[model samples]
Target: MEYMDMYKKWLEFDEDTRKELEGLDEKEIMERFYKELEFGTGGLRGIIGAGTNRMNVYTVRKATQGLANYIKKQGIENPSVAIAYDSRLYSDRFAKEAALILNANGIKTYMYKELRPTPMLSFAVRNLKSTAGIVITASHNPKQYNGYKVYWSDGGQVTEEHAEGILKEITSIDYSDIKTMEFDKAVDLGLFNYIDDEVEKDYVELVKGLTVNWDVVERVKDTLKVIYTPLHGTGNKPVRRVLEEIGYKNVYVVKEQENPDPNFSTVKYPNPEEHEVFTRAIEMAKELEADLIIGTDPDCDRVGVVVKNKEGEYVVLTGNQTGALLTHYILENLKATGKMPENGVVIKTIVTTEMARKIAESFDVEIMDVLTGFKYIGEKIKEFEEKKDRKFIFGFEESYGYLAGDFVRDKDGVIASMLICEMAGFYKLKGMSLYEGLMSLYEKYGYFVEDLKSVTLEGIEGSQRIKEIMEMLRMEPPRDIAGIKVKEVKDYLKGIGDLPKSNVVQIILEDESIITARPSGTEPKIKFYFAVKGKDNAEAKDKVKRIKDEFLKHVKL
Candidate 1:
């Protein structure tokens, strides 16, 4: 049917949706109805409005119906599912809609009673022995966006095989054939079960148990001055509970952003990767004379940190810096205490800093680099568990995602915050701070710096231009960047190492710097990631500017 006919059908919607539709002009209608919102491997994400291209009850119902069919195919004896939602607008409504559709199809759903983080949903899937899990969140996207993500029974985001199977079901099923049962009716029939309090307690305990150095935690539990902000999402309760329960008495919460607000009115963007999101926490840290500040994103899967530098001023550490620091901290403690596993392994994404490799080698541990995404890291954990050759210790991406244990297959900001606090406390006991510890690592590992630049080209033309840019680079590979020789190029689409095929390119320079270019899987943007090591910070900064400027001249973006 044409979007005009669909527009007329929307007339039967509630007053609010009807008003929105009535206000839209022709161009607005075209943009909203140009194409259906895609169901990518990770799942669906889009602006919340009234159209096939938007995220709404209709899209939720259609996607859930597809997922329900896929779940039935898994052939579990009981075949139940776990459902969770964040603090996004209509997230609760979407969760209920998914539950009702699953129940309508005779599959049971364990839905959270309130908003929860992404990692919790992953844990809930395995804890309940369910067929799969659904998370109604867009991670750290802006206020107008919401999303649907799926996790398999292994507690990881669905792998490629599962995603392909689900896509087949989604494409074959017509939107009209999607069915839904009323939420109340499903509950009364015992098809929808609200997750109990014990489940949350078990998850918190699981995180607490993953702490490496309890002695260090106890030594500075009271003196560890830390500030945390959830950025108006789902991290408020669990993050605080884990910290306070672990005996961090001096922990302070950014009171203004502690509660859930769909608008995220306090910050320009709710992403933890953006330094501006820590504005409120930085202020609170300064007033309280805190040693460290932590900020989690909307879903609490990514965390950002601010620590007092030697100059007695606070500085926001980039994700690479924090990952390297944490890597060193975790490994040093393991080796120092004789707890380091003989076959220990640490995993990082391709775009992450190479300082990880240096740290792992210093401990005589193996390092694995997967394509971008925590799911790949999770895949390695499952592989190691089966092979029984290596023990998983730490995993992280350059995008502020990190995982230490296999309890959750995705990044756990809750645990990452705890570990960072503990790491800081250990440094404090040694008469230093995390910032000073980071600088020490630089001194040991030579100065390593990274820079990422994203060129967002939205809509149809932007996408075409992105393709053209990638093709241009592939066809005419750069022989030199900023007078530095390009040693070789690795195209991941043809498969690299033991990794699966992907549309990513790595330009290895003679100086050992790495330049990676890949299109964003979910959004309409192309990102360029640069990594370089130098004798000091200034040389690294200069190298980045020269390489990036030369690279951009070839793209015409």
Candidate 2:
């Protein structure tokens, strides 16, 4: 159908919705309707707009109906699902509509009474033994976006095979025939139940158990000055509650971003990975002379940290650096307390820095590299559960997502917040800053700097352009990058990489610098990850700048 025809369909909508659609430009309508919102391996995520191809009530209903149909086909006698949403616009309504649709199909639904983090929804899935879970969030996306992430019984995002099955079922549905009942009627009929505070309490208890050195926490609790920001999302209350419960006395929340705001009123982008997002928190930290500044994205899945470097200037650490610091801190503490597991494993994505692998090997802990998503780490937890041979220690990705324990299958910023504070306390006790500790790690394990660049390709044409770029790169793999001889190439989509098939490619240089390219599974963008190592911080900084400049030249983007 033409975009103008879709615009006419929008005109047929209710008066209020019609007015909203009419106000949008032709370019906006074309972008929204040029292609249908896909059910990829990461589930559904898209720009919020008025079209069957965008994330709206109609699309949400169709997705729910498809998931409902899939559940019925699986022959689960009493299918039930848990639904939760974050603080994004329309998230609550979307969650309720999804629940009502599922209830209309005779499926039981457990919905959160208020806004909740994505990890809580995962926990609720297993706690309730529901067949599936739905989280209405775009994770770290900007305010104009929203998403629906599906989770399986194990509280992990659906695997490729399962997602494909669900996609098939979704495609089989006709948008006009999906049934949706009134939210109040569904609640009255006993098909919808609101989750209570007991679940939150249980989740808090589980996080508190992940603490390794409560003695240190108690000793340095009052002395450690910590600053935290939730970036105007769901993390504020939970993160603050957890830190307080753990005895962190001087924790300060960024006041402007403490409350949930769908527009993310303070920051240009809600993502914690960006340094600009930390402007407010950094200012507050400077005022308080805090030891560490921490921030979590909207859904509270990824975390970012800023600490005073050796030069006494506050610097934001890359996700890989943060992960390395946390990994080293956790392992060293465990060893000091004689709590190191014999068969422990540190899980990370293939694109993550090799410095973490080196650090893990030093402790005699196994490092397992999986594909990009954190769900792969969750899958490993399930594997460890089935086979008691290996123990899961910690997991992280290059995009600021980290998990210390298996309490929740996905990344929990609440857990990361607590552990980061504890780590800061331990370093402060040693009279060193987290940044100094990071430099010390680099001094001992070689200085490593990692950078990620994403190229956004919007709409249908953009998708094809992304595909063309990937194909071109695969066909004409770079023989050398930035005067460095290309030593090896790992092609993941062909399953012939040095690792496995993962829709990623890694290029090793003669100087041992690394570069990897992969299209993002969750968004309409291709990512380039660069890593360079040097003997010291100064040399590493120089090498990183040169490599990053040359990398862009090579990619010609």
Candidate 3:
């Protein structure tokens, strides 16, 4: 349909939608209806508004109907779906909208009574033995964005095979065929049900059970001062509960950011990876002399940490630093307790720090590399479960997402927050803060530092420019980066090893530094990931700057 036609069609939906479209001019109408919001492997994400290109009730309904059709095609007995939502604007309404649509198709749905973390939705899919799951969240995106992410029975986001199938079903759907029933009517028919707290209890128990060093925690539990902030998202209750249940006595919550706020007024962006998100938490930490600070993003799937260095100044730890520390802690504790699996393995993305590989090697464990995205790690976990040859120990991406256990096949902030607090306490028992603990690791493993830089290019012209840049790099590859010889170039578009094909290119330098360039799957940006090893922090920082500057010089943009 043309933009004007689609605009007219949307106006026929209802009064509210018409009102939303009332003031839109031709340019605005074209922006809204030029194309349908894409349903990719990770599902739909867009600005919340009334349009075919935006996230709204109609889009949600159409997606749900397609999902229902797919479920019916599978022939699973009494197929059901598990639904969860974060604190984003209209998240709850979207969840309910999807549930009613599913119920109208005679497919049952179990939804949370209130907001919950994305990981809990993953767990609920497996715990309830449902066929699939949906989480209404935009994760760390800005306030104007919202999304719907689809998951399979294994609790991992749908990969290529499943996503293609779902996309096919969705494209075949029509507006008239998308069905929905009254929420009350659906509930009375036993097709709509609320997920109870017992399931939440089970999730918390599993996270608590993954504790590595209880003795260290017990010794410093009383004196381990810590502060946490949820950034006005869904992690407040679960993160606090796990810490208290594990006996952290001096834990404090940043009061202003404790509750859910859709606007996320405290920060410019709700992403935990951004240092600005920790402003309030850091203030509380300094006043209280807290040992550690933690912040989780809106959906509670990613966590960021802050700790005091030897100079008594608070500094943010990059995702690589945190992952390396966690890797060391989990491996060391396991070996000490004589529970280290003979086939244990740690998984990381191609863009993550290579320090995890060194830590795994030191402990006689294997390290596996996958494409970026926690779902690939989750996919590896499922593979491990089915193969029985490799035991999944831990997995993380360089984007502040980590998973220590297989109970939930997603980056779980609830579990990562609990483990981080415990790690802090464990080090405190030895008179060392997390910064000291990290330095200790650097002393053992070579000093490895990683940096991520993104260039945002918006709208239609920007998309073409990004594609051109990637093509230029692929066709006319750099001979060297920062005066060093380029050892090899791995183009992921041709399919790297057993991984699926993707539009990514990785350049390996003679000095073993790695530079990966890939367009962001969820955002309109191309990201450059650099990993370098140096004798110390100074050299690493210098090498990162030189390589980053030289690499950017090649791009015409």
Candidate 4:
């Protein structure tokens, strides 16, 4: 079995791996070797280390070999892959290892020399017309973590079918069976190529083209003071360039967190979704009297925002709020410029706030819902482009990921950052802050409050607990919660609504609130999503409280 085989490999490992194996206790050893680091639908993601269950050069090579084989099986001539890396520890090394494996298989490689964002890698896939692409970064995962994401020729994350096929090849192949070559020799053979600054240049131009209100941005550039932080990731250069190119003159960067650091020394977590990630940026904003602050995660696919409310205090805006704000800005500007399409479509994750639907309806643009994950949004964008049915005006999720225009298939924080700055300036010219804009939307569309929480359960016992939770919900559906009747329960595993099968459930309450529960595929956790609407903020808060309390009580986890 692979378990003992990997244990034997550990025994025969080189100096570093042998040391790592010796350091672990029996339980740790089993945990590390009981299973290979799964090449899941999202590719290989785990703690970066020596074990088979961790993301190391060996594991990365194995995944890449599988990807290369898949490309070869497609019978595409001169197959090539584009690779990029973030600033996480060993990310660059892992990326190079992947390229080496792909090169060993006669697949050409186009790689960025320095760290870049996930979205940039997506752009590279389309720009180079590569057969597939790879990015080595954990996104917002903690310092102990690192990841390798694979994208197809479609410029989107590999879909379910491709991932599963590649995973089969990865899982069946022996660890030593993965092919690799010396980096220098690969380069000499022209199998490994470096993507030049031209990619970054074109990427910036592409994102700038997504801007909705350039004239308004220029008008308010000088008067509007803003703070931006990349949180030590790939967003620094591109984000700043787009803002500067669009006439954001008074933009200020948080000096302390400007450069990339693998440990994310300034904050415990590098995720923009967390308010603490904006600590230094917030301090700088207050000192500079900036009206708004924006931050992006390490890989730069997600953006978080902070705005000065009417009370003059800086408050973090939820992903839902930011999505709604961007949706409003883009639609309003399009209509103002007479660029609104009669059948433009906006896309959001099914779990994202319904407020987006209401906003799209107000603008007469059709809004469609997809399963969670930005790849679905990208899938729709590709579909629209192919069918020529409806134009994709915007795509977003509740986790701060957003995309506009068809340039890049993935959610792009670089573009989101530029547009948010421009949107803030548009309102500042009218003597209102971003908070005011959000409040106005709430007033117009009722208060649609949303919340998300993850309950982590680790290892073998923990997985059973997660399974129990899902089974419990399916076997005994709740008919009422806090006196709110349940209207329907949609088990996504049964393949509901034309979406691919997944382990998710959407519970629609009688009052139209939604509660979704699903086990996270990428982490050892189960995520719960809540979206509640009410007449006012207070009422929304109360309903959220009651629903969450009663719902959790029913689950009894």
Candidate 2: tens digits of C-alpha lDDT, residues 354-376: 89998999999999998888988
Query: What are the candidates' C-alpha RMSDs?
Result: 1.5, 1.7, 1.0, 1.1
Per-residue lDDT tens digits for candidate 1, residues 1-557, read 78777777776766877888887898788777777778866788988988878999988888888988988887767888899999999999999999999999999999999999999999999888888999999889889999999898888988889888887888788677898888789989999999988889999999999888889998999888999999999999999999989999998999899999999999988998887888888888889889999999999999998998888888888899999999999999988887898899999999999999999999899999999989999899989988998999999999998899887999989989999999999899989989999889999998999999988887777878989888877888899999999999999999998999999988999999999999987777899999999999899899988888888886664
Candidate 3: pairs in clash:
none
lDDT per residue for candidate 3 within 1-557, as digits (tens), equals 68899899989899999999988898888888988788887799999999988999999999888889988999999999999999999999999999999999999999999999999999999999999999999999999999999999999999888887888899898788999999899999999999989999999999999998788788888998989999999999999999999988998999999999999999999988888888888899989999999999999999999998988878889999999999999999888888788899999999999999999999889999999989999999999999998889999889999999888999999999988988888788788999999999998998998998889897677789999989988999899989999999999999899988999999999999999999987777899999999999899999999999899887754
Query: Quick one: best lDDT, which candidate?
Result: 3
lDDT of 4 by residue, 1-557 (tens): 66656777776758887877775777877778888887766787888787788888778888888888788899999999999999899998989999999999999999998999999999999999999999998889898999989999989999998999899888778767888999999999999999989888998888888778778976888888889999999999989988888777889999888998999999999999888988888889888889889999999999999998878878899999999999999999999998888779999998999999999999888999999999999999999989998899999999899999887999999989988988998888988999999999999998999988789897878889999989988989899998999999999999987988889988999999999998987777899999999999999989988898889888886
Q: Which regions of candidate 3 are displaced past 4 Å?
A: none
Better of 2 and 4 by TM-score: 4
Clashing pairs in model 2? 492-502, 495-501
* Per-model TM-score on C-alpha atoms: 0.97, 0.96, 0.98, 0.98
Rank by lDDT, highest first.
Answer: 3, 1, 4, 2
Off by over 4 Å in 2: 1-7, 23-27, 496-500
Lowest lDDT 10-residue stretch of candidate 1: 5-14
Q: lDDT of all predictions, in order shown?
A: 0.90, 0.87, 0.92, 0.89
Off by over 4 Å in 1: 1-18
